[model samples]
Target: MTGGRGRFITFEGGDGAGKTTQSRLLADHFAAQGRTVVHTREPGGTDFGVEVREIVLHSRSHIDPRAEALLYAADRAHHVATVVRPALERGDVVLQDRYFDSSVAYQGAGRVLDAGQIRDLSIWAVDGLLPDLTILLDLDPSAARARLDVARTRYDRLEAEAAEFHERVRAAFLDLAAAEPERFLVVDAALPVEEIARIVRERVDASA
Candidate 1:
């Protein structure tokens, strides 16, 4: 897929950090510029992935930590193979919501698992396909929660975690961005939506 001259852009952030909104805006911006864009998300990008996503995110019982990690890896493996890679191979800009970084943060930091191992699992699952650019939208967990739709009856498994868990997830995201500064663009998620979109577009234009 890397040989196809296409770009893979991923959004990484804590819950309600506006990844979905920003990813859509970026894809739309590229599309308006006449670029072929494929917008997708982890754990639900393919038919197989959707089933896995439902089990992992909405199951009523407590999932074992390792089992949860493996489930995520399985979804990522299938999603990359069936959706992400093929889209990239076709020379289209692939904008993804929540790639490996989410696993590293949610399962590793939030779930108290080894971060290195979680990263390794994700890398192996995706066959070492890293995003060309990862936009990390940094936000305070409290503020993020406020952005959630309160009218909804239940939160997803990860989103229902305590404030401390979200704090750790946020920290892990920043740590990952720090480790790979060249490949990450850390943005303040509290910015106005249009401003955030403009900054993301500028970065994508400069890099992609």
Candidate 2:
């Protein structure tokens, strides 16, 4: 299967996993290889997504867990329509910093949302689309929180959530990898950022 019009690769894991940095390096690599590259993130790719990002991340007002998951799905659906799909149609490599799996870990595991609900929304929002490869940057909770750039986002709110929740999120990510081994690759993100980038490049090369 050619899948979509192009290749979709997502970077996933808990916060401070160096996803943004790794995505950038991989984009540069693909650009060097002459693959039209599209680098994007969730909850803020488009205008509406930016609004939703604020409401979901920084708002003092409480959002129900299911509602939060739905908002994320809504953001991703809009992002896919406006950003990801079009780029793929143009034969671009769509590299996402965080995609649907973030929802599965953060909302489904961290927020205690029902796993079935998350899975359903994922299926609906993604519309049968799945990443050709997902690079999971695995890190310990304390280590990740220790290196966090500082408390700004909601998941960062979980940094103070103690080590256990972050551990659960980590476990959830590993579980996701186990459930979809062919589509998922785990990397030890606790190492240097350069090493993580190298691992991502290797995975992409192997897949390509």
Candidate 3:
């Protein structure tokens, strides 16, 4: 896949697992090397996506599980069409903080819905676009909570879920990575930030 014009890299993990930090590190590294890199995140990558993200993540009222899943799909469809695909076509590396995997884990596993069906919905929404490399920062929900700057009571909708829900989400992420070892680089989220970034960079460099 690296032989292609542009590379697509995705970061996946539970909340407070340092996905944002590592993704930023990667984008900066590539940009420093004179590569054109587009650093973006799901659910809020575009204007419309931001509205959807707010509804899904910060809404005060209740939302049905299926409604939540569809909202995520809607955001992804627009984000990929307007932001991701265009960057890829221009041969720019796209460092994304999350993608379809989040929907599968959060709405499917965490929400106790059909994982396969949720995955299908996301695949169709994104038109089957897959990342060349997915870096899964695996972390225990307990430790992840400790790493968060915000109080637990102040967590977003998804982040405020029960521990058991987060466990299901973590398991789903591991299962997805296990099913696609060639496309996933699983790392311990407890590792030092610089060390984690180094490993990610090595994988990207080798693939490049």
Candidate 4:
């Protein structure tokens, strides 16, 4: 169990925040340090997850919030049991692009579900699995959106959401980091990608 799966590091942020780029850098760094690093993403990390992702992210019309939450939770449960846990047990450093944090921000904050309720449901869904670290690449909503052009999926439905809603999600994410200072990494992602990557490199190396 200890030979391959090392630790699980998750990268989380709003769209256009450059988490995927930074996560890969960190994964490569870990690999250079002689660890087995697996770079993956949520909602589509497995075959079933891939199928579910389309239903969740690509629905043509508005889907009920409660139903969307259930879909995300279900995808997460499958991802953990099939993809995440096995990688961890193999001692691979799992670098995930998005995870539970998305549910908390999107469904809890954006969807108007009571934060406490979402937290409880998420806890039950994942059965206590938590990231070793969550790097939140903080950026202004408008700036991020401009960089992103337009959202392409039903998940992007949230993309067209009111700025106030995204603001709430941002505040909630910040609050989450505040609540758990040790595990939440707040970075100013408004900087140029390379500069942001540099800061990420410094921070991740320190953490590693």
lDDT of 1 by residue, 92-175 (tens): 899999999999999999999999999999999989999999999999999999888663567998888899999999999999
Candidate models: Cα lDDT each: 0.91, 0.84, 0.92, 0.81
Judge candidate 1 against the unseen true structure and give its global Cα lDDT, from 0 to 1: 0.91
Clashes of each: 0, 0, 0, 7
* Models ranked on lDDT: 3, 1, 2, 4
Candidate 2's C-alpha runs over 4 A off are 1-3, 149-160
| TM-score versus the correct structure, for each prediction | 0.96, 0.92, 0.96, 0.90
Better of 3 and 4 by TM-score: 3
**Residue 93 lDDT, candidate 1, scale 0-100:** 92
- Among these predictions, the greatest lDDT belongs to 3
Q: Please, what are the lDDT tens digits per residue for candidate 3 over residues 123-176?
A: 999898999999999999989988775645577999888899999999999999
The 10-residue segment of model 3 with minimum total lDDT is 146-155
Worst 10 residues of 4 by lDDT: 150-159
Screening candidate 1 with a backbone cut-off below 3 angstroms (N, C-alpha, C), the clashing residue pairs are none
Please state the error at residue 165 of candidate 4 in Å.
2.1
Native-referenced Cα lDDT, model 3: 0.92
Expressed as tens digits, the lDDT of each residue in 123-175 for candidate 2 is 68868678889999998877787677464444534445667778888999999
Cα lDDT tens digits for candidate 4, 97-194: 98888888889988988777777777788777888778899988888777777534333566677889888888888888899888888999888777
Backbone clash pairs in model 1 (N, Cα, C under 3 Å; residues 3+ apart or in different chains), count: 0
